[model samples]
Target: MRRRNVLRACLILLAASQLPSPAQAEQIIRMSTTYTTADSGLLAYLLPMFEKRTGAEVKVVITGTGKALELAKHGEVDVSLTHARPAEDKLVAEGYGVKRHDVMYNDFILVGPANDPAGIKGGKDVIAAMKKIIAGKARFVSRGDNSGTDLIEKAYWKQIGDRPQAPAYISAGAGMGEALTMAADKEAYALTDRATFAAYKAKTGLVVAVEGDPKMFNPYGIIAVNPAKYPGVNYKGATQLIDWITSDEGQRAIAAFRVAGQQVFFPSAKVGR
Candidate 1:
């Protein structure tokens, strides 16, 4: 089916939700994502599709990856979709989450002011390039939050074995977009996922300085909270949402997602052959 037809159908089903019976009204699933639904027009199509199919209304909360994982740690939400791998691994190992599965992958790029002050644009090694930025004491902004990007940034810091100018390094405990804005304002260097970076690059005036180092690959995962750890958890509904998202149906919907004809996320779960 065409995207328009599919979206139209979802809109109709969601509109009917306003008149749903008591049973329908009681079925809801709270979903949390690091990125806002408004970041992608595809969200306008997804929220309703899931609701119509399972009679589970999706309540969306947008927060930084750190807080989103914390919400899961505390059993504050039913489902989570985020791109941070190390944090997700920690969450699962600690018995707070389960049903881990790879969903998508995007690259991370080191973007900096267009002046090329650190001359990091053509650096073959990302860590070496980072060392140069630190040696130069050039301004470097960090997402600081335990976001996947932040986790990776710290890992690279360890790799280089030197702290960038402490006072020069600004840790913005905010979302990816906000961090990019600050980086632009200060003409500083920051690492960002290609999807989010591309979404805001034009307005932020930041240019990609480093990429394809084999270490900047960003992979996203989806999972549910382990009900055994929290009895009140909606394990059944959470299972349903995961099954739907990884199903052929949901995979197809994701692969078809595009912004200005550019594919931002490559679906890990490919639809039927």
Candidate 2:
């Protein structure tokens, strides 16, 4: 009986040795995405589906698109999902990102108080609307956080050759949601992604003042951090995520995410970045 017990114990030890350790047994994909995606609860809605299909857990770090790309540049995250086409292209050109795949998009809108202090309501031209807002010295809230929206706002100011130095022009130095909230609280105008704006519109009581401009189009792209640069990064998992997100199932999931019965983000996997 003693000999039989010893053999059973040895067999169990061998079986355990054959099994992978905890770290090897499970995969974790680190991702950095824009605050809009996270705040709109899209990630919350879609991550579970991916996890269910792939059995790999996702660790998310939410910030602006600029910061998300920065995380990818440092190999701090295995992948990034962000909008900001210029910045995304730069990262890929600089060799930090392996490839960029078109994911989804939502246009930016000028949202402000229903009173329309800037007289930009229903404006078809964003440049003209911004000029009106500046001329009237209407209150405007800027994200001022080197975010994608901030970059676009700065470009608008540059186009008009005027910076908002007036006291009415406030810099929130925060994300889209916070900037929109600040705008709502102060009754100031702000540019925000449609998805986030829709999510917060009722709560903030802000209305879309300007939209449908060609330049208002916002496109999101997904990039897998180059594994060659950082071998420690989960390249395999990142690829899996990117492929799955661009697949039919992923596009369908994106289309399915809606805020208040209104579809905010549109699927762009079929389109090019």
Candidate 3:
């Protein structure tokens, strides 16, 4: 009987060892997002709460909106959050994404050195401001990475039918934060989302050079990659994050987030998808 009891205990231990470990069983979802969302400290502020509530971990890949959507297109990520609306619609229309949910919004602003070499400070017209920069041949830093901000900047130049010449137009080919730092370092003008500008305001010493332009309105959206296209993706986990982020609680949290003692992103979740 003693031998039998010992054998039984050993069997129990072997069975336990065969079971999956806690970490291995834990749910995880991969997300690709814009640099602005990450740099503005929004993800850092909200992701922890999500992990605690759902017992799931979110692996984030930070990149420009264009690249973020590209990752989703390849099914490399379970979800994507980006600021380019037209691109987001295209992704869904092409059936790469399940659906798009309105996440939040913030306006883009033109920022430059305090001295305002372009003489565009306090202007509400972005095109007018760009014209001033071109007229003065003021150094203008550009992300030049085909990012959403870059697209907008290029569009403004297209609208004006002019751009700063090569020497004056510095294509940093970097992210928003880095472009802003480059702008500051070069005492140049650059267009940026307000949230990132707010976060880097003190560090960059770049003041808002132009704002309040209706054309500068920027909106963000979140979409889960289609599981049909990528069977390996964690669709259930992605849906959980999507539903949670658009829920009332999540919208409230977004609304409450602030930088430099001022709210930067405003919640715009319609709350159903």
Candidate 4:
């Protein structure tokens, strides 16, 4: 009887080995995302849940939106999460992106010293606030790395037709977190994503000087790298991730994320499916 039991166990083990392993089999999906996403704590909260649900590992590469899109264009990543709409559209137009899906949105805010040297506090119009900053020559720190925030800042500058003069305009060539930090240290003004700014708010001591302008709206999108361009790209994993993130579950998770109990990112994607 004992021999028969042992034989049965061996047969069961053999059958289990023959069956397909986990669907992902611990496959790793390479993902690129903007620094704002990483610094805002969204990625940290969502990735682990996604990994647990899919049985797949995600390798995240954090950088500016331009760099993230470039990595996806080269197929160095399976998907990219970024906020630069024009550049993201260009990626798809150029055939490097398989598809783009709206992920989430927040708004850009002008953060400056508590003293309000530019006197932009309580302003509802972003353009007017920018004009005030430039006119006042208030010290301003710029994330000059061509990030999504930087692009928006440049557009505002173009609208006013004058760049912040030297000594007043300090280009940090860094991420949102660093730009905020520099702005705090220099007691300058900066344009930053609300989520990232909130995350670093306690440390930076910068106040939201201006907001509520429609032009300050910031949207994020996720793009799956084109498998046709790079045959080795993990298209399956990318699709799964995109589908999951756009699903009801993922949208709720994003909405639930907060900083200091204040919801930072609002779910903007179409729910379901």
RMSD of each: 10.0, 5.8, 5.5, 7.5
Better of 2 and 4 by lDDT: 4
Which lDDT tens digits does candidate 4 get at residues 1-273? 999999999999999999746564427789999899988898999999898998888899998888899899998999999999999999999999988999899999988999999899999899898899888989999999988888889988998899889999999999999999999999999999999998999998989999899999999999999989998888989999999888898999999999878899999898864
TM-score of each: 0.83, 0.89, 0.90, 0.90
- Clashes per prediction? 0, 0, 0, 0
lDDT ranking, best first: 3, 4, 2, 1
For each candidate in the order shown, give its overall lDDT on alpha carbons. Answer: 0.80, 0.90, 0.92, 0.91
lDDT of 2 by residue, 1-273 (tens): 999999999999999999867676337899999888977879999999999999899999998778899999999999999988889999989999998899998888999999998889998789999999888889999998887888888888999999556688899888888999999999999989888898898899999899999989989899999988888898999999998899889999999999888898888897333
Clash pairs, candidate 1, are none
lDDT of 3 by residue, 1-273 (tens): 999999999999999999857565438789999889888899999999999999899999998889999999999999999999999999999999999999899999999999998888989999999999999999999999888898889899999999999899999988999999999999999999999999999999989989999999999999999988988788888899988888999999999999988999999988654
TM-score of 4: 0.90
Return the lDDT, model 4, position 238. 91
Give me the runs in candidate 3 sitting further than 4 Å from their true place: 1-26
- Candidate 1 residues 1-273, lDDT tens each? 699999999999998877857565347676678763335454676667888888787777787677888898899887788877878888999999985777777777899999978989967588888998998889999988887778889999997777686778999988788899999999999988777777788899999999888998877777798888887767777788888877888877777777656776777854343
Poorly placed runs, candidate 2 (over 4 Å): 1-26, 271-273
The model with the greater TM-score, 1 or 4, is 4
Identify the candidate with maximal lDDT. Answer: 3
